[model samples]
Target: MSVAEPRRIVLFRHAKADWPQVTDHERPLAERGRKDAAVAGRRLAGTGVPFDLALCSTATRTRETWKLAVHELPQRPKTVYEERVYEASPGELIAVLNETPDDVRNLILVGHNPGIQGLAEVLSGSAEGDARERMTRRGFPAAAFALVSFEGSWKTLEPGVATLLDYWAPSE
Candidate 1:
């Protein structure tokens, strides 16, 4: 039997956003946000994981975060911006992942929180260790990144079925 390759998903929260002068959806990334995005991007790239696709939210800040993060990647992945991701619930985020094409194994989801954070926690389940404890205590902060790996198709993903491979956030 052929070995099944593990599927990986990277959940990233948008970097810091500028103060509100416009609608929430229109808020742009601040200078700090830009720098943070770059740092997070490099960190993600350093993991040596090649992303096959990126599913991003349509909001300006979210979109900008994805653009800046992907800049550090060696290969640019196909990206799709979905309106449903903006202010999405944890279930909604899972739904988005469920819809991904089966051929795309390594996928990234760049959006906001606590949806991102919540999804990370839910997927982590009872997999306890230093990383899980650390993430639990700190919570998923801005520009935080969580890499989860599972052994099946994207459509079959469910809570507590994936392991947290790594978690990181941009330095202050």
Candidate 2:
């Protein structure tokens, strides 16, 4: 894609996790999470974004979430299980995104919050229609995702550069 072409980032928070005896990183998705994840995937497919890549956290819940969600998409994007995304802060998440290959025009990030939520808020300089309001009001709940778009190279992705195009939560 040309540098001037718009790039889209989907910030997706992992689904709710079960309280297993395993480590936090090993905890799997809850029953509700399983159902919600598929629903999220269907909704994402509905957007017709044609995602090129998925940057997913390495945590078990996040991995599980992606597995279920991707099944609902028309085509699966290349996935990278990134450890840096696990428990990362908003700035840290942005740093990870900055490393994304310029060839990727549409990217989906499956991780945890408040980093996902924080990233959504930090990068969104503005929003379309009621997107910002809905995102703020609904909050970034589990299985929630926000779509943001910007025009620039991945290296230039920074605070306040993107526009919040849409937001979705399983509940809504």
Candidate 3:
């Protein structure tokens, strides 16, 4: 797709994690998280966005979430396990995204909040319909995702540059 064509970024927060004896980075997902991750995956597939790449945090929970979620996609995109996404702030996440090659028109980032939620709020200048309201009301819970659309190269991404097109969370 050309730079003129719109690009999409899916900001996905990892599902609930279990408080294990391991370090925070090594904690695994809870049973509920496993199920929710799969459901979120199916929901994402329903959106019909053919993702070109996935940038996943190297944390165990995020990795597991992506593993289950990607299974439901029609076709799995190329995935990169990046340590930088572990506890990155919104600005840091933007830096990582800015490095994305232009060929990736649709991309997903599987990570933890408040970075994920912060990124959504930072990037979305406006929203379509009740997307922003719903996102705020629902509170970027486990297994939730916000889909933002913008134009231009990934390097051009910045605050107020994208529109929050949709938000989804598993029904409690």
Error of 1 at 78 (Å): 0.3
TM-score of each candidate structure, all chains considered together: 0.94, 0.98, 0.99
Runs of candidate 3 with Cα error greater than 4 angstroms are none
- Arranged by TM-score with the best first, the candidates are 3, 2, 1
lDDT of 2 by residue, 1-172 (tens): 7989999999999998999799999999999999999999999999999999999999999999999999999999999999999999999999999998999999999999999999999999999999999999999999999999999999999999999999999873
Best by TM-score: 3
lDDT of 2: 0.96
| Tens-digit lDDT track of model 3 for 1-172 | 7998999999999998999899999999999999999999999999999999999999999999999999999999999999999999999999999999999999999999999999999999999999999999999999999999999999999999999999999999
Clash pairs detected, candidate 2: none
Per-residue error at 112 for model 2, in Å?
Answer: 0.5
Q: How close is candidate 1 to the true structure, as a TM-score?
A: 0.94
